[model samples]
Every structure is written in structure tokens, then in C-alpha cells.
Target: NDFPLVLQVGEEVVSLGRIACPIILTTLLIHSRSIVSTLFLSHLGDVELAGGSLALGFYNITGVSVMKGLSAGMDPICGQAFGAKRWAVLSQTYQKMLCLLLLASTLLICLLWLNLEPIFLRHALGAGQPTRAQWTSVIGISLAFGYAILACVFTNFLGEAWGKLYTQDPDVVKLISIGLPIVGLCELGNAPQTAACGVLSGTARPKEGARINLFAFYLVGFPVAILLTFQLKMGYRGLWLGLFSAQVACVSMMLYTLLKTDWKHQAKRAEELTAAVGERDDLEDGLINDSNDER
Candidate 1:
């Protein structure tokens, strides 16, 4: 009874768990920088907060979207090579994708870093605080989003009860202080959750991602947010708390999945897949060369 016994688990269970864990960790590492920046800006006062929010929004739309989109095409290639055990191709693909992202980030910095003032002004002009009545109606609509950006915007609105867009009210600042940190926590969690999904896709396990998303966000997160925000009268903090809980849950679940993965098998499969892809490319190149020689 005192002896430690090792029980052999099924391969599928192991594979799913191990694959899922790194994805969650990788995602969190990648996304935490932005959320941390937002958290810092939230402490700086209303103008800085709003300007920072606008900058983040612009970065997501222009820079982040482009980078994710371009890099996404490589997922299947990596996944297939991984699954096929093509090690060399997998390594090359991984390196090439990294290079591509670096290039993209450089280009984006050149474009966005130089034009931030204009972007902030454009967003600031459209920014306004709604009354409590308006907010009640707005929250209903905003609850659908994973990150309720409007909640951040309206944290300042708590001070603008008279319907003014800008305010120097201490009450609003007090409310903002309470809500913004929660926003930071929620956003920080989003990184790992999104990275887990990306990893799942790269492993050709999108259904696992779908399942995790449904259970984590809908079953656990959504109810908690509803309960905290509406039932507890916790307001924006409650909603963000719910989001933080969801991210934690998602990370936990994904971690469990990744811990179970058969990495040796995955490596073998990657090597096989990479070799097949390389041969196909060689054949295509040869055919093109032959036609050019004939011409």
C-alpha cells in the first residue's frame, strides 16, 4: 500500500493533454504584454486610458489582424507535418513563420508607431459617456463580447452622470479605479485562452478547441458573469471577474489536455509530413523548370 504505482493511461488522453498545455502557456506569454500595457495606462488618468484603449484597438485591427492572418496559413502546414512526423520540414516551417512575423511586426511598427496621434484623435472625438440609463441598455448588448470594450469606455461614464463626454468628477475616477484592474486581469487571461485555441488548430484538433471554448466560456464564464454583474450588483468588476475565472478555467482544462500528449509520436509524425511536403515541392519545381527549358 505504501509503494508508488504508475498506471499507464490511454494514448489519446495523453496526446490531447500535452498538446493543449503549451498552447495555453504560449498564448499567455504572447498576449500578456499588451494587457500589461493597458493596465499601466488605466492608472494614468482618463485621457491616457482612452488614448491607450484607442491605440490598442487600432493595433488589433491593423497590426495584430494582419500578422495573425498571414501566420495562420502556416498552421495546417505545421500541423500536417507534425502529424506526419516530418521533423525537418516542421523546423523549417516554424523558423520561416517566425521570420515572417518578425518582418510583419517591423512593417507594422513603422506604419502604426508613426501615426498614433492621429489614431488617438480620431477615436477620442467619437468617445462619449452615456448616462446610467443609457449604460443599462448598453450593458445588455455589450455582454456578448469576450472583452467588453464598452465597459472600459463607460468606467469614466460613471462620473459623467450629467451626460457630458468628459468629466473631472472624483466619483467617476473612483469607479474607474475599481473597474480598470479587473479589465486588466480579464485581458491577461485572454492571451492564454486564445493561444490554446491556436495551438489546437496547429495540432489538427480544432474540435477540441471548440469544446474547450463552449465549456469554458459558455458553461462556466457566462453564468458567472451574469451572476456577478446582475445578481451581486458588482457591476463591471463582476463582469471582468467572470471573464478572469473563465480564462483560468480554460487554462486549466487546456493544461490537462497538453500534459497527456505523446510528444515522441508527434515528433515522428511531423518528420513524415515535412518530407512529403518537400518532395511535392521538388516535383512541382522540376515540372516548371522542364517547361521553361522546352520553351
Candidate 2:
């Protein structure tokens, strides 16, 4: 009964208070970390803090736009398969979506990591700016993302499954499983790719649903992404520590979920449902559309 449920409700008021709720929440989440980083920067002097804030604002706008667009693509495919009860289609779509997102993340990591110095230099060069120190921070963030990013693909996977199982198809369950040790081992690798809690929450199978993505992107990931490019404590290393820890926590939860569930019956039901739907559509065959394909 506990899960990320999609709400469908009738329209209500669009009052100023209502309108401002999301906006206020969003701004705070966005600014919090960089605010902390900026506090650190300001102690270094005025110029650094101003540069940190400015560079961060610009990066947030660009990254949020892209992340939302991708969410649209993911939402529709999963929604339709789920509403229509098409398990095989859902599985196949996941495969394609994953491959595409992997390439996209790789490109995103490369572009930001490589251009961060130039990006900050352009904005940080203003008068009274903490130019060199801020530049160092920006460069650091860029390098931190270079680790192999498994990211949170499982979060989305689980979120979709949550809807199907806990809701209309309580009988539906996912067959795919990920072990805790392997998930942890992956986190420790040299590449320092995206880890458990955060990635799983944001990408693979977000339990709090897209809020995980929304929060991680705007709040957690955004500042982390920016700070890596903004400071020099351990250079790139210090910047990524918060984010790495977030993902590790998320991954552990997902792996644990896998071990505790016994819903093979759910998946079996979903599979049967797909076949039943196909049969009811009344093609030329009963259950065997392809004689050679029968299992």
C-alpha cells in the first residue's frame, strides 16, 4: 500500500499561495547547497561568492530544462504500457530508453566536465569577483562527474513497477533483481559512478516518484554538479563526496527491496495478461501467433 502513487484529481484553486508553493520549494532546494558553497566562498572574500552564485544560476537553468524533457519521454511510455497492461512492451521500452539515457548521460558528463572552466571564466571575470578561486571550484566540479556513471536507472524501473503492482495490478511484480553487495561494489569502483540511494531514487526506480528526480536534480544534483565546478578543497574530490554518499544510500534501499519481495506471481500474472489481451484482440491465432516462438 505504501508507494509512489499517481494522483488524478479535479481542478482546484490557483491562488497566489497555491502558485507560490512549488516555486518557493524549488528555489530553496536549488539554492541551498550552492548557498553553503557560496558561504564558504564568501569567507574567501566577496569575489568568489558572487562568482559561485552567478555560475550556479546559469548551470541550473540549462540542466533543469534538459532533465524535464527527458522525464516527459519516460513518463508517457511507461504510463501507456501500464494503463494498457503491456508488460513485454514495457520491458522493451525500458531497454531502449536505458541505452539512450546512458549515451545522453555520457555526453552530458563530457560536455559539462570539459567546458566548465571556460563557462565560469566567462561569468566569473566580472569586476570585484573572486575570479581565480571560483574558477578553481568550477573546474573541480567538472572533473568529479568523469567517473563511470551507473546513475539511478533502477529508480525509474521500480517506480513504474510500483504503480503497476500496488495499484491496478497488485498481481504485477518485477522479475529483475539486483544484489546489495554488487550494488555496493559498483559504487566503490574507480570511476565513482552514480551510486545506490540517489541514482536509484532519481533515475532507476524513484519511490517518492519523480520528486526524487525533481529534488535530486534541482536540490542535490544541481548544487553538487555546480560545486564540483566551483571549489578546490580536495579539488574535484571534495565536491563529489556529498553526491556519492547520496547515491550509495539510495542503492542500498533498492537492493534490499529486491531481496525482501516475493512477487514472481505478480510478473507471471502480468505476462498472462499480455497474452490474454492479444488473444482477445482476435487475430488469426489462439495463443500461438508464431508457432516457432512458443515457450
Question: What tens-digit string does per-residue lDDT give for candidate 1 at 1-295?
Answer: 3221233123322433464457548668867877778667766777896898898889789887787666665564554544344556556766776777777788777331111001111111112111221222122222223343444355444533421223355776566567666665565456555544544443334556668878999999999999999999998788878888888788678656655544334333333323443444432232233333220
Cα RMSD, each candidate: 17.2, 25.1
TM-score, each model? 0.45, 0.28
After superposition of all CA atoms, the RMSD between model 1 and the true structure is 17.2
lDDT tens string, model 2, 192-236?
A: 222222222211133433443355446664566456646544444
Candidate 2 residue-wise lDDT at 110: 25
Number of the predicted model whose lDDT against the real structure is largest:
1
Clashes of each: 28, 32
Candidate 2 — worst ten consecutive residues by lDDT sum?
113-122
Model 2 regions lying over 4 Å from their true place: 1-31, 110-295
Off by over 4 Å in 1: 1-52, 75-169, 180-207, 277-295
Model 2 residue 249 distance off true place after TM-score fit, in angstroms: 41
Q: What lDDT score belongs to each candidate, Candidate 1 first? A: 0.52, 0.38
